[model samples]
Target: APAPPAKKPEIKAREGFEVDGQESDDLPPVFTTVPTKEKIVFLTIDDGAEKDPAFLRMMSELKIPYTVFLTDEEIKDDYGYFKKMQARGVTLNNHTLSHPYLPALSYEEQKHEICGMQDVMEKRYGKRPVLFRPPFGNYDRDTLRAAKSCGIEYAPIWSEEVFVDHWEYREWDQDLHPGDIVLTHFRGTDDWDG
Candidate 1:
């Protein structure tokens, strides 16, 4: 009989957040946080409702790196705004075509929503993204299948979400952990007074 393939060894991080180093080609990557001892956190901004130049300036001055998950409907009116951010080295990812609930839709519908956004992002930003976030942080098995078919490499949900002045935590501790992914949306003073 033929010998079975040896298991890939896992690489441990010295400090800070690290993803499991074991490589698997068949499985799609789904992550909430990278496992590590470092005190680092990742910030992800969803939607594109507000295009605040001051906010951009502040983030740029702070040198914070965040990923933006843009919806076509929210950003089509001011695509140039995101273009400026992209020029500043910020990454723009896919949220969906119209921000529909993925689990509510069929697999083909889900694929259309995701792939359509990918087409728009590539046409507007000149690069196809490999990161996706379903609308309302809702998805199902078909969503993953659709995302994988569309070439997404990672799908992550938030550990915490921040509004204009307060934070909402998914964890009961209400405290941040290493490699935590934070979520925030684009909103103006109308949405929540700052």
Candidate 2:
């Protein structure tokens, strides 16, 4: 048998310049807070309305609330899956259109990406997301400002997140800590759910 791969920590690092809708080609550093006295965690899924039926079913049976960030590009195929889950629980957030790397695009481009998706989701499901999640956890100054102007207050990401089981099952071991956000994808995902 082959040796198993080394387990790397899946912590999302950010910079102080973490802004939304910037074209710096580099995500600004970030600031993260550790909750001192709380026992809760947040599990978030990325992309929109995946076609996988089993994952959808698993989501419903899990009986836990999760946040879903949608990029307009992902819904070009339609968002039937999302519309169904919206009724169940999954709260939607704004990702962007075409899943462009926000930090790599100019300020104007970044704003368009984030705000554009907000419009798409609102029009499709009548739900406007109040949170933003940048692709690949990357962001710069431009990214942040654009998101805030769009009514987003938080840059939601995983606290102690990882993919397990062939990278198919998205898992976040928040250890039941408060304000813990988990990250996952929808279509053609590479999460190991172990």
Candidate 3:
């Protein structure tokens, strides 16, 4: 056997957030932190505008784990790129079909945006994601309802966003917590070159 593929390190789940069979009946568990004392943070990248091979190679070599929230419009052009990332153990989640502001849309419209993407994702990726992140970190009660109806179990917004040069914090203290979620994006050199 070819060295029996190396086993990846298992991620320790934060307290109060069981990794298996943890379900909620109210609002799909909106959270910004994982509620743990461990000095580990979750990485989430939103949008799929850039499909750089170099980025994939770097991430694969480093063996970093992250989730990607993909908008259909941006990623529909080159989903195979994402499939390659998926092969490397990245989880693909839903952003939306058009990246609309969910709060501005009606309940039906919100359902269409979310459920539509769910269908597309299932067809393309062979799995329906149970996690969703609303666009621009904006959503309302209806958005949560729509996500629930579409079978999403969690909705997580970032506590901070990491840019090429600096970190943007949502808290006044401007410090990172133990289980804080960090957000980034798929951008080419043009978007971050400045």
Best by lDDT: 3
lDDT of 1 by residue, 1-194 (tens): 12212652232322322223313333244556656556778899999999999988999998887889999999999999999999998899999999998888998999999999999999999999988987887776677778878788677777889987789987789899987889999988888788
- Which candidate comes out best when scored by TM-score? 3
Residue-wise lDDT of candidate 3 within 93-151, one digit each (tens)? 99999999888999999999999999999999999999899999887777878898988
What TM-score against the true fold does each predicted structure earn?
0.85, 0.71, 0.86
Q: Per-residue lDDT tens digits of candidate 2, residues 2-121?
A: 222266323233444344433353332232332333454556777764567787688678666677878777776878777877878668778889888777899889989988888888
Off by over 4 Å in 2: 1-36, 166-178, 187-194
* Candidate ranking (TM-score, best to worst): 3, 1, 2
Ranking by lDDT: 3, 1, 2
Deviation in Å, model 1, residue 183 alpha carbon: 0.2
Q: Which residue window of length 10 is worst by lDDT in model 3?
A: 1-10
TM-score of 1: 0.85
Q: Report lDDT (CA) for all predictions.
A: 0.80, 0.65, 0.83
- The candidate, 1 or 2, that scores higher on lDDT is 1
Query: What is the C-alpha RMSD, rounded to one decimal, of candidate 1?
Result: 8.6
